[model samples]
Target chain A: MTDRNPMKDQVAIVGLGSTGFSREGGASSLSMALAAATEAITDAGLTAADIDGIVATNEPGASGPEAIAAGLGITEATHHTKPTPVAVFSLLDAARAVFTGAADHVLVVTPVVMGPWNSRRAAADPWRRGARSGILPVPEDATMAAAYAAWASRYIHEFGATKDPFARVAINSRTNAAANPLAAVDTPLSFGAYEAARMIREPLNIYDMDLPVDGADAFVLTSAERARSLPHTPVLIHAATSGIVGKNDEDQLDGLHRTGQHVVVDQLRRTSDIWIDDIDLFYPYEGFTIITLTWFENCGFCPPGEAERFLREHWNDDAQRIEIHGRIPVNTHGGSLSEGATRGTGHLREAVHQLRGTAGARQVDGARAALVTPGGFFFNPQGAVLRTAT
Target chain B: MNGNSEETDEETDDVLIARFAGNGITRDSADHFRGRLDRRLLMARCADCGRWQHPPRPMCPACWSWNMTMDEVSGRGTIHLLMVLHQGPPATGVDYSTGHPVVTVELEEQRALRFTSTVSDDFPAEDLAIGTAVEVEWIERDGTPMPVFRKAAS
Candidate 1:
């Protein structure tokens, strides 16, 4: 098989927009999604009709992409597709679509509404039901919780890392979120408060996980040479790369310090000669606290097993500084933990927001370069580096 | 499983029940189901593929060939990864919101099997490491056997 790296070539994000992050909102996922893309197009000084492709998250059939395109009054061209999940998936798809010459000036959108059901609301939305019910077909053992929990158990055994230190990640994320007006949880927190909050899993608590919100975020990327011509200040896609390892579905549970996310980072870093430390900002798709720790360490942000310590002293470091910023920044948009789950697309939109200097209160000053990494629990992950190529 | 012979419906909650196939898994996995009828834990070895297939399949996932059979594993592995959820055994009507930890064990056959149950009582409170030895167990959920693991026999 040939190694297909769709990240080659350069594209610029000239337009970006998103809806207010929330659950149980006034508009349908489609209408809310349309509003976001339209805003980005308008910001780019391009009429919605100029949009060539629609990259979308969290909708079924042709309804989601077509609806957004139709609402923008743009003709439905070759819109992209990924089984609706998160913002990062849409962003990655948009980049790939652009790379494939599938479309120029692509609009990436994510729409989430806390589904109207108990199980969907309480734990996670059901993907295993239809496939298992023979309503749809999928590979076996594809959606098993015990596999992940068991995998977490394996990480615990090998790394000597436990819940408490990881919980501090949640605390820090929430603390960062407090400064973000767009963040869902406006309430401030203390370490003691985090410790006092009722634990959900032994180590992962209610705070450690991201808030399940309903909304959409959108961005428009074009050729880098045309970036300045667009209405918004565009960020160039310097390099986009994706990787997977060892049937990544359960390989995270395979051995010590071995994870699919890490392999993807290593592959991208090795090929591009761009070390993780050179990254100005990180928009890691945050599903939980452990996810970030794994990325920070495995991506060469720090040596293995030092993620917690590095994060612990992040506030005190001068060498870790990126740009003139006081310290390296991760998830400046309140992240999935704080920003009400931009879904996967949120991570991409946030990266665009930072580069566009439109991230509002959470915008990191002098943020010229940024990295966006999106991952999947069932093992699909893609990462990109977005920078001010001007 | 929704009351069919082709697949088995294992209830994760009142609403969610995952499906298991006896159609394409390995003979060891097939026998594992047989052992399940007697409430025994089972896994498979894809000798050709040189890898273990959990929740096994008839064809080797690695080699993509049907030239594979089942063999009983020693049922020994390590607790390589874990996550303590703030939630519980799926939508159980319990006031205690301190959800149980979810664990994944790397089995002795060199495959990962997932389990969501209370951590073993003997486990430590802080600073846990990876690669701790594990012994598998079955948690009976409404008569269906849900596999869980504890730190190996010390």
Candidate 2:
């Protein structure tokens, strides 16, 4: 069977906007989505009526594309999508809609409410029950952090890596976030403080976890040709791909460092002639510190088991001077760790900003292209290469 | 370790018992391979591909064969991974606020059958390490039997 040519440099992200990251209570999911979506459309110099496609990240009963469309007073959407689980998937959908001539001016939105919940409180929410019963078969006795902790344990065992590298990741993320005015947690992370942090799980402390924050992030995608006619410089969608390993439904009990992850990285690289060195910035999802570590290895940033060493030799060398500002910066917007986790949509928005040179304080110097990978437990991993329109 | 199933309908004050939400549910296709802590036999192997799997599913992941069989595995393995959670949602009435170590074991019979269970309070926390050998035992929490692990004698 002939492989389909990569959908490289076809679509461009014309506008990127967010309601800024917060620790909840500012607004509801629909309101945040509306604000972000509206910002994106207006930033693209297009009215809501100009958007004909909508792709909303699906959170059951959570307001989706239809609500955002109506909230924006968009009269109609010719190609509306059901709520998707992953932001990258929604992005791919938006890009495809523009690529396939399905629609122009596609809007993608994901909003999340990041607040604490308890078992008793969960019992009161009908939507919570549906999530527990139908979609995720998580054991009741299992703690929320069990899965990542397990993967980390195995990673430590197999690689002989210590918690120091993971600590560094948290430190770097916070250091970057400190420069970000909209970051949820902007406090500078020191190694001493990170080490002193109480361990929530062995080998994982509070520093290793990503804080849940309330906010929404949205983007506007159109044909590269169309993007040229718009207001802002277009961040061309150079390449993109998404898939799962073994089976999509298999419980990932084996571990997080899957063979399939390498496949994704390779396929994304093949989408364009761009090598890893050509990319100016990197944004691997930081849901957990170990996630970034594994991505570093699997995404071919460094050889296997060399991520920690690479960090030691390169990242930690100039912590105060070059930590946030680096040769190839990772998570310039602080990522989910310090930047608010808008269910990971924040990473995409940050990538677009970095590419456009619009990321003010945390901007990477002369960033022309970026590699963004979004992944988590049970997610069909997805990735994209975004480059500035030359 | 073997014991009768602690199947009950009455609400118990056991926090871990309260956490056991999949109490009544059972998969129909793989009834032979039971995960109940009380079961002497656990895990299923594909009769066609000889692949061993746990939390029993219908087909073999390796060979995708419907031919499968069940048998008891040696209730011993090394801790493949572990997490000691200090702060977590409180179990119904039990005070786990101090936290507990959750472990995943790579079974000696088949590494694919990784079983996750909490270590007993008596298990040495300071000694826990990856690759440390452990043995399974059935214990009752508020009269509800569940599987737990203890460090194996060297």
Candidate 3:
């Protein structure tokens, strides 16, 4: 076992906690991050002092590692920052922290404002202040919509997929979100709701977008041996990998199909002992419906362009439609679409819930194995395979 | 901010700072020649390499020579790709969409030339194909003639 995968039987997340995901919530990054850290420490039956290591993710204008470390009163471990503000990057940061022997237990967290994206856009778009990039960015709102429009058009022109099939994803996510407390847009989404929307870019309508919200979320990851003594069941981070694929590896946002998550997941499935089909559920970090579809296809869960067809065939009203890939639940905590945006951190918490069986109303029965694929725009992807370590 | 931008009284189109791809330029100046269409020419001549460069740069990439001058070359290039955007408001106004033709015109002198202009609003999508011969048509916008593309007769 020692000679085998070092990460194996090494570290697992035993505790987790988060703060309210709000868009207009006035808490600064430090305030919300601290709030999340405090909750996780208490939940883990420890104190801020117990955490000698801190893994902090830097948001656009938020706290960097030094600030997050000082704020948490933690003096140790590695500090990492991603291009995006998503928490999924922080999850990997914690995994690295525990593996490196730099810290005993690591807490990963990120706090961000969410709400009508138009509002967040005003705050997030740095160029609005005349900080010129020389090259104009295709509008943020219009970018995904345009890509999807082009993709959907190509899919229609090539694979024979139509708008009706694509509508099922929005409906299903909403259906699942209705039960999730963290969900932001859990309303009655109908074909009418999807069709009546104006085209922001081609093919993608308003219904296909995600609501921005404000919030911070954190998860406590510790050694698997220590997790055995914890109060709650532990979900061991079996295999963790982050993938950066697409055009211009450093620049990101080049190729959507070959994202880091897809590459890592493919390697995991091929080399690891478990097949993707064996996984009990998936926590796909979704910012929109198209990203979800693309992940499903790119992960080899389904063939390219067949995501919509798979949903229609499998997601019957009587059946548990949320089990996205071959009956495995995807984003049971309502995903980014339903759950208030945690910038990828929310998905991490959802993975823990399913593993601990503490998911309550949204629990997946007999969920012993779970995978969290967290990502957003530009196809920057990271995935962690977690198992309930007895 | 004006209607048709092409019909505007501005002598030439504003130096369209257009898309900020953010990659720094790598060439130098050669000559500051004006367009044959008339008015305000901007070119670059590498201070070292004796080569004519447009879309002015501070140095010549090929010879690593700073001996470059800024000059205007005939804004003529062949169309690499052209698309008809039936949707979205015109770049210059709110109600009327540019029906503008955004062409990736490969410059006759340099490696690239791509600018936004309204060759036709109603050009069907099928009519536009790869390798269409096109030349620059400066539609006056603001104060400069905005670089646009027109069908170069085969």
Give DockQ for candidates 1 onward, in order. 0.31, 0.33, 0.09
- How many pairs collide in each candidate, listed in order? 56, 1, 63
Model number with the top DockQ: 2
Off by over 4 Å in 3: A1-5, A75-84, A114-117, A120-156, A249-261, A318-320, A324-326, A376-379, B1-91, B94-120, B125-154
Candidate 3 residue-wise lDDT, A1-390, digit = tens? 334456764788877877756445545667777888788878887776667666666554456666766887775554344435565567766777788776787777676653223354534545323222222222211232234443344345455567765566666667777777766666757778777866554455556656666567777888877778777887877776666643321221323445565676765664345556778887766565666776677777679778777767667665335555456766766667666556667777887888888888888788888777776434456777778875
Ranking the candidates on TM-score from highest down gives 2, 1, 3
lDDT of 1 by residue, A311-341 (tens): 6666423322212124567776557777765
Model 1 misses residue A36 by how many Å?
A: 1.5
**Winner by lDDT:** 2
Comparing 2 and 3 on TM-score, the stronger one: 2
Q: Estimate each model's TM-score.
A: 0.79, 0.87, 0.73
